[model samples]
Target chain A: MKLRVIGAVAILLSVIIASCQSEEQQEFQRYYNGGKIIYEQRCQNCHSAKGEGLSNLIPPLTDATYLKTNKAALACLVKYGIKETIITINGKSYEGAMPATDLAPVDIAKVLTYVTNSFGNKMGIVTSEQIDKDLLKCK
Target chain B: MKKLTGALFIILLYTACKFNAADTPKLPIYGNRDTASKVVNGKTVIDSVYQTIPSFKFVNQYGDSITNKSLNGYVYVADFFFTTCPSICPIMHRNMLKVYDDYKNVSDFKIISHTIDPKHDSVAVLKKYADKLGISGNSWWLLQGKKEETYQLGEKSYLVAVKEDSGTPGGYVHQGWFVLIDKQKRIRGYYDGTDEKQVDKLRADIKTLLAETNTNIAQ
Candidate 1:
């Protein structure tokens, strides 16, 4: 009986420990407004408020089709503006070289994260580290 | 002599007609005149421009339930943000408070702030934040609810950008915009939530929208 009681207590403790060890909550640092202030000051003029590209002038960020296939292209576009180039969103096409902005890598990460997440487009999180890697690749 | 006589006769005739026309039973300019009717039409068009509020129910800062119906017939500014945001959220929120303070007593205006990060930004946390901001009464309402719903409302309904990002400067992220909703709840325009000059433009537009009568509702 003593052994059984000890065994039960041990099982209970282990269960508690297991519960506490749950991995659902991961430690990840999010962007500060995803460079929202920087984006507004610099990007809102062309991107518009809702991330919906201006009619025929710019491509909407919520373009589900483009988002599915052009993740790298999107990053590259932000890092290096598409001057005198055209990009398509959804089915519509846009022609304009969005000026290559002078934002830091972290700022780029935040703004890209914001654009990806907003405008009915829900891409995963973008990190400054990722931005750094991506920037290096571009160079 | 003949030409002079003809000119004088013509002048007299013109003067007489003009005098008679002025004296004829003229329509009252105050209430029932063409100019008045045109002014009335302009007001009607202005009022028609405001949009209708969509139906939604969410928790308020006081942990109380609030809905779109509560904001019926009121002009309010709506924006989405999370508390721990380390970026434009603070600046945007400060600007929103400024708007609220200026228009709290106006009766026709109100403010709604929705949290994009519902999991972390519970009613309790939002309540604390609102208290910190000194929001009391019905003038300003802080809301939090299902994350997807908030995102949809921000992007589709309000025509502003919002999303859930784990890599934001904080743990969450959203747009830096203050969307202007007229009394009828239509999106009149969007202003830079973080820029002071843009905020001023927002204020002027708000005043203008308020002055215009709510008229059109695009179904």
Candidate 2:
């Protein structure tokens, strides 16, 4: 009888663990979905839903050159502001100023993660740890 | 009846195309500014593209040397950003991604990004940021150098303004305008990288630039 009881307990435990795993997956999806919301509220103004930029003024994050080369710089730009800077994109020169924003680290991570993933930008995840590292530099 | 409808549709399409073509006039390759303005403290009267894009050395995301001389005779799009910007950086980057892909095939054009927060946006950090953005090779550059020089370039050469505001939580504050420089290094146009209408204007300007490259000046 005790052995049978043990088997039943084991099965129950397995079922619970499986449910928990599924729940975790759902939670992650929520976070990703939340990132989309954030993108619409904040990112859509400057970066159109299509990710096409405003002429020669802004560099497109969807391009492989930026996704491949300036991941860290991109992060810093999102966290801090490019107060006075000059950048070249697609064989053009632009001297513009970008100010820092006031989003938290997690929000920054999710938004950046969204940009890194969207617009043909197939790049790795930008974790909160990486955001923290970039934030430290901003300080 | 079906054949008549199809013929009418074709005629309408052709008329629309013709109307659009006629409505769009040939704008200058780079925009023209007729005013004599003071970029700096009542000194250095600016003229044309020849007076802009002066030679200066700065490090790329990979920490390589980049100078105005190095980029001579090339068309490019340049903007400024740091890794930690919270508001428009992501949006600007999203649009920039499109610009990069659209022009990735054009060998004569390149992309440049300047770090406004130089003290914090170092080469190593910029490299990591570039990596996250999936930027690789020589197609794009994230540059950073002295703060004053960059500010001057933005204010005078590029004709944009910048300043730092520690009172604001972000430590540094600045404008969000993007300047378009021509092959001859002249300030051709200014666009709101954060605005959609302005971006469309930029796209049209780029198309104009490409078309004008093959045409000779009509003196």
Candidate 3:
């Protein structure tokens, strides 16, 4: 009887874990879809649909190292334009300045999350709170 | 009733043939038209003679003067944009770059990028901008000329619109058109430089123009 009770507990725990994972997956999908729409409307013209960017004129966001290391700067850059600085990604330098996007904090977060997690990246999601904090620190 | 049906069918066939003949694509020769008298089948007929693009001079990114003389016997594409443009210029630049790449190896084909903001985009600035875009050699030229002359060329030569506006982001407004000029310096086609599909059409039309040039030379 004790073994049967333990087995029931194991089944319940597995079911809860599965549901939790699915819920997380669903939330990620929501962020990704919303972020894709925003990116297509605003960012795709310069950065391209896959974030591959134009040749030497714009920097590619596909580099996982760049995206992971510059998470805060990415959020800030989205809110405010990066002027007077040349950004280098994966040893290739881009000279053009990134224009500031007039996106809200929530939308900025979604775009950041979408880019970071896309184009062969798995850097995870960026929250609106993070974007708000980053924007506060933008120069 | 049968005879009426036969007559209607004959009329429809004639109309369709006439329409198909009219639909044949022909390059328009722009500018002032002049009438020339011709005797055809013992009858006097008047035909219109079309003019070509007028001669002008502008300084290229290298600070060298480029004139209509330099563009003689060549097919070219021309457009207007400024470097610091915050909006449509980049899209146009990207599209123009695609056209440049496609025709870079072709002889006697050129791309002229004239800056509407000539004051800010001097020879030095245009040179730097061209360098940043990796545009080297003579296939493409970044031109900076007098504001009045550039504006006039935009309206008169390329048949594009340009003006200044304080409320606009770039402080100036211009159309995003790549005007295709044939070897005779006549405007052949205009493509929206910001649209990829239009740029594709521009590429295809370039091929057609080149074929037409070849056929003329052969003749």
Best by TM-score: 3
Which residue pairs does candidate 3 place in steric collision?
A: none
In the range B1-219, model 2's lDDT, one tens digit per residue, is 999999999999999999977555354434334545556776777653334666777899887889997677666777877766655666666656666777777777778878889998999888877765656777778889998888787766666666787775356566556666667776666778777578778767776765665353332
Error of 1 at A95 (Å): 49
> If you assessed candidate 1 against the hidden native complex, which CAPRI class would it receive?
incorrect
**TM-score attained by chain A of model 2:** 0.71
**Which candidate has the highest DockQ of all?**
3
Better of 1 and 2 by TM-score: 2
Candidates in order have lDDT scores of: 0.70, 0.70, 0.85
Model 3 DockQ vs. reference:
0.41
True-structure lDDT of candidate 1: 0.70
Q: Which ten residues in a row have the lowest lDDT in candidate 3 chain A?
A: A48-57
Flag regions of model 1 displaced more than 4 Å: A1-139, B1-53, B214-219
After best superposition, candidate 1 residue A33: deviation in angstroms?
26
Please provide TM-scores, in order, for all candidate models, with all chains considered together. 0.47, 0.52, 0.81
- Which is the winner by DockQ between candidate 2 and candidate 3? 3
lDDT preference between candidates 1 and 3, better one = 3
Worst window of 10 by summed lDDT in candidate 3 chain B? B22-31
lDDT by residue for model 3 over B12-125, one digit each (tens)?
Answer: 999999997555435655555689999999999998765567877899999999998999888999999998887687788888888899999999799998898988999998
Q: Give the Å error, residue B192, model 1.
A: 0.5
**Winner by TM-score between candidate 3 and candidate 2:** 3
